[model samples]
Target: MIYWSANSTNSNQQSLSGSNPKKKVHSGNANNELEWRDLEDYPLNLSQQEVMIEEGKAGSSWGKSEINSGYNSLLSRTLQVKGSKVNCFFDTEAPKILVVDDHAASRMTAAALLAMEGYEVIEADSGAAAVVLVTQKHPDLILLDVMMPGMDGFEVCHLLKQDEHTRLIPVIFITALNDRRSRIRGIEVGADDFLTKPFDRVELAARVKSLVRQKRLNEDLDHAEQVLFSIARAIESRDPNTGDHCERLVTLGQNFGEYLNLSRSQLRDLMWGGYLHDIGKVGIPDAVLLKNEQLTLEDWEMMQQHVLIGEKICQPLRSMRGVIPIIRHHHERWNGSGYPDGLKSNEIPFLAQVFQLIDIYDALTSERPYKRAFSPAEALSVMWEETQAGWRNPELMQRFTDFIHTYNLK
Candidate 1:
């Protein structure tokens, strides 16, 4: 039948549907299906939603008993679809989806439906709780109720999208209202999809499956980028002079981005840029690469080519698109003085700007064999001199210095 179910006896068995309610429909008993009346006329809309959400309403009597039986179309009549192809994103790990609804009865119903569809369901009763849960638990998907009391689904989605930690999580708004304005509002607030009240059980299950699959694919992409970064960092470590350069610069670039209040995507790109900015140096010859002395003009040009090399190396990786700018443009000065392209002022990528400043700062403060390291304050002063000499952005440097002092970053 159309019911999605997994046998409870086999925990290792991965199935698209949960076994309990789905089992009732598929157990071949026919008695459970017989017990379920046709719900074709059930008005799945806002009033029914208010009844479930608000106490002392006309349809408040709708309970879990009704929800469990609401959608069990015959398998023979179910819509046929091709099975998903297994790829890097397809894995045995079951995705966790957070279901947020102010009404417990309604929430339990949705959770049961999703759980039957082979997803691990995490439940939250309110919008505020969902926000906190999203920050701490980082669920792969959120099915949020639009009718919460204090912070509604739209507000919760907005808040989560605004935070770097939770921004990547996909949001699907579940609402009783099917109006054009409500749908538009949900979209404006960053919702990926919408599930109207009294939704078709099959449609609901399909939507959940689609989003969870997409999220898993995204996770695999993230994993790929992580692997690429590891390889790049390993290459960087070949030079004895690196000494925590990538990690420390990542911290500083992230801090500066935070101080500037950049968006989550901007901040995340900076972090990636920090790790892979020197990735192309892996291609440079050691003679010029490890040299501590001032570079001759030829050596300098060869060294600068590392930027172009780094960009080319990462160009093929679809997942590393965000990181390429930092890798290639981190050396570009504000006044068109730095290599490799000498992109001036705002022409430089914003993320590259943040990374470049910290890249220089970290080098200045880190102790080297030929020269003593500058203290944090001294490092800032030296960097300020670069700003004055048109080697860096004067305004951005001023803000970064302010952030350093305000946060007491040493």
Candidate 2:
């Protein structure tokens, strides 16, 4: 039995559909005309939702292989706000939630509660159906029932968590079983929270709201990283020497970070930092960047300014604050000798240090104007020489080298 007490407080009681519809267009170019989509004015009623579901089901059968990319295009929009980082508006569209349970009553009750608060809700009656819905609907949060006929909640969660695209969507297990073993299993499978069956309405709303807010923050942060990477990649495209160097750094760096059992935050920073470390180069002149011979002192000085330029370029975006150190400090030396700032050794940001190693490895392996590409063995030997001169962290170098060789990172 689930309790469904309505919110009685008179202070600002409005259902999601009844809320203000006139939203500032979160998308479109500022240089042209701004466009606004009033969500409240065009709310989807039950009948409309049924029609969309039926249409989606019919479309699904035609392209079963494309289910991996199935996204509820109806619920999500590409939010592109234009302006200087300062003059822009930041708004998050409402969170899309998927409620998965065998009981129709539970799904209806939960959906009504979530909708009243402001979240858009979708329903899935079985684990298999929920898995399919996840890829297609792309819900921000999932409330899953523990016991079902074939695929249990634990199995469903494991499968979702295994997929990178769906993993970030938080899963809260709803179960009648309150045993220690069941709880342990949920944690093992990466369930974010647990709701013991026979639910409390207030608790449900609170948990859903809290999780959705956190997920939104993470999504925003990820979007920021992607923008930074894309800008850098565009600049890299101008130079023939760099192809997918920035992207490769992210992939290789993430692998090395994981092999070392680095925390999730550290790995995220490594990926973002690897792509962004050279963003300062976007400002460097082509003469200095593309010169075949060694750089003159003047050209070297101008090149060095890239790090500072990158730091200033990213300063306006609050979402990129975590990566600032990485952009600024990656060129710093192990022995207080390298770039923009003279600070060395422990003065280097830890995350920057992690990415610096990845950046160097990628560069060494890549073909450049003045240098031939080095094989993996040759690259390791060169890095060893740097360690001998105290130019790099000996311990981190050793671990990174071992990981690459062990995994055959090519």
Candidate 3:
């Protein structure tokens, strides 16, 4: 939530009729004059009025989906603004909000207010309806009404919070319930905040704006933690034998990447990728991945599929786009004998190359099903031997060795 110090003046205009409507008329030359009119201002016949009455609520400003989207956007944007890093939640994108309410009048009112203050808004009508819409829409904030017939706001909030899939969403109760008891009830039921009926237009805008900033920051932090935990879990699940390996790997990889003069972005991705380098193993059968004996040709093929599987799993992270290539091709040898894609030398992704060297070192120094852990010196000797066979870049190997020497990576 990047805070823009813009004054958001909530407009009192009737709900906008539809998505920006435009009309065109022939520019009158010297003889004629150009004409223009708002499509909404046009009077309607009886049949047209009926159609308008039916569709007007949905088509007008602040439909159910639009309002819910506005609220959610506000929450996400606020969290982002308060988060540790700038542009943490959004990737050069505008904040969007979602509002959920049954009444079209309320929907339009909320949308008009939010729009006047510079928010992109979407709306949903009911709790049950919002569940499906929210999953697909993923608005930043949710403005939920407390009293709906089928599933009330509390039920909706509980459902959202309970779902591991959408639990991180921040919900603010927007209702006419101004009583202290009602507000407390709203809070008790999992609402982050409550906005009463007849909310001050200016105050409402300011509060929404402020909340959006805070929500964005929180979401940014949440997203970072989520990524870190995901990577850690992926590795732990893959190599259950190496307890705490992911932690050591992250610490060591961060230092090693820093030694290699990696950019901040590169360092971040390398740290994550390094910690979860063996995540692909999760896809391998337990027998193959945890084999106590040397792998046969078939077992080796199965073992190698982990890299591709890991790549697919990590593909959703647009931030780690660079990491995916490295993760996928890390096993390739310098001589092009690697499984999956047999790219050689400079063709291998650099992050994967770095992880390749560290990963091998870690594996050698850690206990496995088949053998006891090797001494640091023995691991170093093995790496040296592998280098001679053109399995790794000598310079990178040396750099890794220097890292071990400098940091005493144990």
Best by lDDT: 2
What is the lDDT for 47 in model 1?
A: 27
Q: Give the TM-score of candidate 3.
A: 0.49
lDDT of 2 by residue, 188-218 (tens): 9999999875566678877987787788788
lDDT of each residue in 1-410, candidate 3, tens digit only = 00011111221122223334232212222211112223222322112112122343222222234434544422111111122121343455545567777765565456444543445566666787678767876876788888877888989998888887677667888776546766777777678778876546666665666677777776776686577568657658666787777777777788888889999998888887766566676678888867777899999878889888888766776665877876788888888988688899989888888888877888899997777999888999999999999999888998888888887745
Return whichever of 2 and 3 wins on lDDT: 2
> What TM-score fits each model?
0.59, 0.67, 0.49
Candidate maximizing TM-score: 2
lDDT of 1: 0.69
- Ten residues in a row with the worst lDDT in model 2? 5-14
TM-score of model 1 vs. true structure:
0.59
In terms of lDDT, model 2 sits at: 0.70
Ordered list by TM-score, greatest first: 2, 1, 3
